[model samples]
Target: MEPLIKIEHMYKIYNPGDDEVRALDDVSMEIQRGELTAIIGHSGSGKSTLMNMLGCLDIPTSGKYFLNGKDVFSMTDNQLSDIRNQEIGFIFQGFNLIANLDALGNVELPLIYRGIDKKTRQELSREALRMVGLEPRIHHKPSEMSGGQQQRVAVARAIAAKPPIILADEPTGNLDSHSTEEILQILKGLHEAGRTVIIITHDPDIASQTDRVVQIKDGKIEKDYWNEKE
Candidate 1:
């Protein structure tokens, strides 16, 4: 079977001259379906650029990205948007919840964008919240919740649509240790439940939890290896 994501000889260069910045330099890798992987790097180590490329939020300057065997660069803008909506769910470190919207409402936003019916979206949203242990806080706005609760709501929102891949960029960056563990457990559960979960972070502790770690530095992949967990 083909890998779910494949990139070959990829490069993302900015300015393209004497002062050009190569955010990604000849990077190449493949991610099989249902793998729990981590791409770790420091702040300027090109991990974010790679994340944007993986998420289909940005295109590389050169090279190929095949998502599910489809050439990503060949996609039109609308096609890219549709694929992003249907194939990957994103969880950001900031939670990114709307201050005015309650947990349920926030969780339903993506479904709404996907044109799901009100009744169905509400059902999915509630179920997602329940999965993240936020059933009781369904109607609470972001302002009324703790940071962990808000992040749980964000997780609910990301999973509400059942996207096959969960791309989390520093999902636990803003949380306390307790909250970080909570989020990590949730992500682990998601991985065990058959989703492809990819986490991008600078924290080795976070990377250790994943099955595979791909470390990036200076726009290159420094190491890629599987963790030996007993």
Candidate 2:
């Protein structure tokens, strides 16, 4: 079977007048379904750029990218927007929740964009919040919950659309050890349930838990390996 995601010779050059910087250099990668992959690298290693491309948030300057065997660059703007809304979910380091919106509200935002009816959105959002073990905190705002709970809500928001792939960047960076472990368990559960999970982080400890690891250096992939022990 074909890979769920395939990126070939991808390049991203940010040209702001005289300062032309290459964020990604001939980067190539493929991620299979039902796998948790961790991308590790230092600052300016192009890991973030690569993540943006993989998440369908940014287009590459050159080369080909295919998500679910569909050419990413060939997609119309609306199609790409639809993919971002429906096929891929994103969890940011900051949680990125609207401060005033409660957990259920935040989780329901994406479904609302999809034009789903009110009753269906509420039902789906409730199911997603339950999946992340955040059912009890559905009505609580971000500031009203602990960091781990907020992150759990964020994860719920990401998965509410039933996206096939989840792109999480530094998911555990701001959490304490206990919270980190909780978040890790949640991600592992998602992966075990047949979802594709990709994380970008600099923490070796976090990378160790994933099923696969890809190291990047100076905008290029240095190593990619699968961990069968997972």
Candidate 3:
């Protein structure tokens, strides 16, 4: 089977020339469909740059990236936006929920952007909230909810469209221990349901939950291996 994602000799450099910094230096990797993986690295270790490349948020300075067999850089800006909406679901540690939008509204925003009709968006948003165990808080805004509840809302917003890949960046950075466990369990459930889940975290415990871990350091891949103990 073709790889779900493939990157060959990828390089992302900032301020190229006299004082250049390589965020990603020649990163070549292939991730299969339905694999639950974690990319672990501390700040300045290039994990964030790798995530940006994987999510197609920023184009690499050189090399190639293929998601689902299509060259990512070959697409136009609008096409890239469409691919981001349809192929990748992002869950950030910051939650990124709008203060004014209620949980259901937040979950529905992406669908709205995708031009989904109101009736279907409503149904899908409700289903997504239910999946995150936030059905009761559907009408509550971010200010009305606890941090964990707000993060759950974020997760709902990410998965509402059932995108092919769930790319999470430090998903537990802000929550308490209990909330972190809750979020981790939800992600695990998604993986169990056959979603391609990629978690970007510096926490070793968080990385231990995934089927595999790729460690990045100094703008290069330092390690890539399955976690047999996990």
* Most accurate candidate by TM-score: 1
What are the per-residue Cα lDDT tens digits for candidate 3 across 44-90?
A: 99999999989989999999999999999999999999989999999
Query: On residues 1-230, what C-alpha lDDT tens digit does candidate 1 reach at each position?
Result: 99999999999999999999999999999999999999999999999999999999999999999999999998999999999999999999999998889999999999999999999999999999999999998999999999999999999999999999999999999999999999999999999999999999999999999999999998999999999999
Displacement of residue 167 (Cα, Å) in model 3 is 0.6
lDDT of 1 at 221: 96
Report, for every candidate in turn, its global Cα lDDT versus the true structure.
0.97, 0.91, 0.96
Q: Could you tell which candidate, 2 or 3, scores higher by TM-score?
A: 3
For each candidate, give its TM-score against the true structure. Answer: 0.99, 0.95, 0.98
> lDDT by residue for model 2 over 98-174, one digit each (tens)?
99999999999988889999999999999999988889888999999998899999999998888898899999889
The clash numbers for all candidates, in the given order, read 0, 0, 0
Cα-based lDDT at residue 108, candidate 2? 93
lDDT of 3 at 36: 95
Lowest lDDT sum, 10 consecutive residues, model 2, at 16-25
Candidate with the greatest lDDT versus the true structure: 1
